[model samples]
Target: MRLADRIAVVSTEDAVRASVSYDQLRAGDGALYWLETRPEVGGVATVTCWRPGEGARDVSPEGFDVTSGVHAYGGGAFAVIDGTLWCVGGDGLYRSRLHDDQLELVSLGSFGDLTIGDGELLAVRESEHGDDLIAVSLTGVPDIRALATCRGFLGAPRPGSGMLAWTTWSEPDMPWDRCEIWVASYSPRGQVGNPVMLAGGSEESAVEPRWGPDGALYFVSDRSGWWNLYRWDGHQVKRVAPIAGECAAEPWELGYASYDFLDDGRIVVAVQDGPRHGLVVIDPDGTVRPVDLPYTSIKPYLAVQGTTVALIGASPTAAPQVALVHLTAADPQVEVLARSEHAKLDGAQVSTPTELRVHVAGDREVIALVYPPTASAADWRAPVIVRAHPGPTASCLLRLDWQAQFFTSRGFAVVDVDYLGSTGYGRVFREALYGRWGLDDVDDCAAVADHLLATGRAVPGQVFIRGASAGGYTALHAVAQSGPFAAATAVSAIVDPDRWAETVPRFQRAHARRLRGGAGRVNAATVQRPVLLVHGTADDVAVVEDVRELADQLTAHSVPHDMLLLPDVGHYVATSTQAGTALEAELAHYRFVMTAAAAD
Candidate 1:
């Protein structure tokens, strides 16, 4: 098929979308609820429930914006209690009986981490001062009462008999950086007693606290330099099957669950090893066994009912889907409950990624997933597109990405580079870019491209780079610092580090400084290749004005470039329309640069 046809295939509304988004996995009463975003519905959060031998059903009320806006990057938006569905919506907290078609607004306010217990919804409410733990009565009365306050941030409020366990972290420290699990005594009268620290401290990061059937607190902590599971035995915490792998990810938002305890005391958890993940079950004696699964990517959202573990997972050939795996089965039965959407590509159209570990400066290593062009009969060497993933802290996994295939299916080798600061690696690796952000991330991406060239995987002088947000910053830096990249495309790129920091939340501003550093600046004059800047006017994170200023500067320096201003869009290309436009703009940029190179 033609490149345009491939792009159209991936960009169409019916294309397979990722169903297992953040904090969308919840299970109760033998049923599992998976929150999905449908382009047909303009990417609205829709809850789909599944039961044994039953078909999937849409439980969310029609036309309700059941999404959480607590931290901007929403997650932990919905939770199911005793077959009743409670979700955060625009007007406040909303509830829908699992089998009912009617919706009732229960509370009024933005909330996160909705944990159900004591006949109420306990969540972290976003207030003017900061985030606090509050209990909202499940009755339609909208009676909101504060359970805990004066904390910079609070999450994972697991309510149990006479106790409430949650995680807290102050500003200047992201959840994965430093957080503590606190367990407090609770009373029926909405009274919260003094809290006791279960695990974590200034130098340790603890998250995802939950109470088991026996009322023993369980959580994940990075005290040993890896995010591993631990059991809090009222007075002390003990490591559960300590391993070298990561059991928790960067808690960018609320409602991150790496593991859940089964009724029989067995624990079903997802452990991330580099970019791939493995589902494992741990007996009380600490005997760990891997569950048979075909997926290479698994989210932190895990729900366990008896011996069955439900998670959102994906393989190289399949988009992410809600999966139910029976742990005790002789073969570890795996069942895909709900998919993101029907995949538009056949098995031949999918590009399987080959892992690439390149040793860069000082013998330090960086990892990336390289997808070769999928043209079976192409005669010429394929061009390469090196993508710097966002969240300079986020790692690129080996999942089926339609966008990456959109390029590979059209004779372009796409490389997803996980730079120095990416997670999934240990904390030491993650903090590698602490004092060196733009420089290290930029160099790592370039290194991946250079490695591909050296190994004869890419066509020389035909390489391009593209990214959005922080990745965009790295893409721009790569062009400015060291690049003969045919062309560069940056969506909402950070032109100035200092200016970008101002737009970030106060807690994240410090990390922004670490990424940009004192000498960080985007010199338009230094850009040798053509550039394309795509931004949305509604993006408050990397405000459109900041990106526009960079585009103007590029023009002032007479740098050949193009800019696309999308109105009413946010930091992300959410809607199908926005994604289609961005994909087309990127294609145009690549074509323009290739033509210009040919002329030269």
Candidate 2:
């Protein structure tokens, strides 16, 4: 099939069939419950319940959004309590009766990381002042009591048998940067004692607290340069296993669980080592054994009940799926429970990514996932699309992104660079962009483009770049800094760092100024290549004014460019329809630029 056909299949056909984003995986009452968000349904989060023999069923009511806007990047939106599901809906907490579809609003507040224990549900409620952990009773007027209050934020409310554990951090520091783990005695009536800081400090980031089968507290901390597993043994914190891999996940959103304790003294963990991932079992004695799993990408959401492990897993060729593994079997057996989408394509047509370590400035190495064009023609080199991922802090996982396939199927080599500020590498690599945000990322993108052209993996003078949000800013900055890319496309691009500062949180304002460098305003003379800019009119992250100001600058300089203002969309174009349109427009613009270059 052609590129357009592949795009259509990915955007409509496959998306309609699957389009699932699962999280909040919980096991209780000999069953499992998970939250599934579907873009086809306008990205509404729904709770799905599954029994060993009864099959899966949706417990969420129709027209209800079981999600939280606590951190914008929402997670830990729902909690399953005694077979009943409690979720954050709109501006209130809603509880759903599992047997029937009846839903009731339990409380009036925005909540996340809902934890249930001792006949009560605990959550971190977000408000204008800050975030606090509060307990909502299941009965008796449904009284809400403040369990723990932090000066800045509180989340990951994990209520154990008789103890309550949560993570706290103040502003100027994201959760991944630095967070403290606190534990308190729990009582059915109310909190019994004061919460004590167990592990973590201003320099250390401790997250994902859970109680073992033996009632011991376990968590992941980055005190050893890499995020590793640790346990709080009564008085002090002890290491479960001091492996050099990062088991602690970045808390970009609230409800993430990376590791879980089995009834046996074994703990199953998902570790991020560079671009690859592994699933390992850590015994009580700190012995680690790697479990052979077929999936390449495993989400932080994990749940374990006895010998069963349930997770959201994906491979290089498969979309994200809800999978269950039987750990007790002589050979661990994996069963596919639910899939987001099943794209029917031949194995040969799918391009498997090859991880590359490209050398950059200061003798540093940046990783890039390269996908060769999956086309019949082999003698000719394909034009490359260097896609800089968003989050500047986030790395592109080794999973099947149909959007990348849309270009690869059309005989284009795609390279996703994990530049300097990306996670999954240790804290040092993530902190590489501490004072230099846009410049370092911009250089890394151009460096990868240069490496690809030098190696003849990409066609010269035909390299194109695409990005969104932070990545968009890098794309625009890279194009102006270098002469490698023939054209570039940026969606919700941050063109001016100074103007962009106003849109971000108060804590990031200083870091935003560092992005303002020697690169002055882009004009017709400075930027010679054609550019395409797409911005959602309702984008609140990098406000519309940033794009309008850049458009005005481009117009004043008479630079060749195209801009599209999408209505009602926010910082991200959530729907597949909008994404497909943006992809088509980007490809069309690239073709026009290539044709003009060829004619010249």
Candidate 3:
């Protein structure tokens, strides 16, 4: 098979049709429910329910798109309350019983972080003004009551016992950077009393507030330099089975449940150490024991009922699947609830990632995941691609990434750089990019490429760098600076940090400014290498105009570059029909660069 054909097997529309993404796992009333995002259906998200005897079935009402627009990157869009599934459909909030087709509209608006309250649904509603907490009536004619109005962002409005808990953070700080958990007396009639600051501050980031089975408010805090579980027992807050690894994932979206309570009063928590993820059971007496599982990566959303846990798990060889684990068994067995129809690849076709650490900046070690070429050739160095993950805050996982495999299977080595600002590491490491976003991230990517070339793992003058969103910004800057990279591809790249800060959504305005932190703008004049710029016309986060301006500058400087702008596409291009086209263009761009360099 041709190299392009091997790459197409993972990047084409057929691959998208064969793939599925599961999110928001929730268990209640002896059933497991989750949101399945199918790209074949135009990325329509629907709720599915599965039971012991009965097979899995879609429970979302026909013609209803179960999604939320609260934070733009919506999550926590559905909740199972009293046997009825309440979800944010395309036009309004709706409720329906399991296996029933009767969908009743509850309210109209963009809402997320859906939680079951006392006879009501608690959610965070987004509007032009700002975000606010609201209570929706379960009965009567769609009575929507504002529980709390805040000038900043609000999410995870969990209601338990007689109190309602939620997270709030203002501008200039992302939730992971800084946030507070608040609690208030909640009445069944949708009335809320004065809120009290429970736990969190500028220095301590707290999130994922859940009411424990013991009526204590449990949450995740990074006070000890790592995101660990904490419990608030009416008057005092205390750590729960404290561990060095992060027990909660970054709050990119609201309503992530990293840990859940079992009926036996034990806690099932998903802990992430570097790129690997595993489950640990914490006893009431503060003992933590690892749960043996085959999956290497677990999503943040999980639920526990009795000793049964429902989660979305993935490994190097398998796509993510919704699974149920019975912890009470002698050897806990994972029950496959739903698996994606991905094309099965043999061991020879798969490239497993290994940890690569390089010391830079005078003893500061940088971490990365290196995937060597799966196609073997004697004494031939492979071309390398250094990937800068977006979020600038997010870390690359150990899960099976078809995109990375696309290059590895085609005789290209891929290195995913986990720069200073990336998560999965502790807070100190994550916060290292606070004032050095573009600078440190760019250096890290360039350094990784340098190390690969120096160690003979990468072909000299054939290394390329690529990224999306903030990582795109890093790639653009890296190619502009002195580096071993021969070419660059930036998707939805932030061309100008100042402009990005002004045009980005209110939630991340401060984050943009903080990340930029005294860094100069991208100097297109310094970019001598070929560049490929891919952007979506409808991207609100990194507006298309900025990329256009950068392209104009590159043209003015007589630089060789190609630009691909997809119409009607948003910030994320992974699932779009145009994704395959973009990938092909990128591969061609790199090949052309190599050919030109070899001729010279």
Number of the top candidate by TM-score? 3
TM-scores of all candidate predictions against the true structure:
0.94, 0.93, 0.95
Across residues 557-596, which tens digit of lDDT does each residue of candidate 2 receive?
A: 8877899888776677634236656777887888888888
Tell me how far the alpha carbon of residue 77 in candidate 3 is from the true structure, in angstroms, after superposition. 1.2
Q: Is 2 or 3 the stronger prediction by TM-score?
A: 3
| Candidate 2 TM-score over all chains jointly | 0.93
Best-first order by TM-score: 3, 1, 2
lDDT (0 to 1) per candidate: 0.78, 0.77, 0.84
State the lDDT of candidate 3 residue by residue for 389-502, as single tens digits.
Answer: 999888877877766776776678889988888888899988888778778888888888898888888999899999999989888888887789999999988988888888
Q: Model 2 residue 251 lDDT?
A: 81
Instruction: Evaluate residue 152 in candidate 2 and report its C-alpha lDDT on the 0 to 100 scale.
Output: 79
Rate residue 557 of model 1 by lDDT.
97
Stretches > 4 Å off in candidate 2: 1-19, 99-102, 343-348, 376-380, 505-525, 574-577
Return whichever of 1 and 3 wins on TM-score: 3
RMSD of 3: 2.7
Report the poorest 10 consecutive residues by lDDT, candidate 2: 7-16
- What's the best-to-worst order under lDDT? 3, 1, 2
lDDT of 3 at 235: 90
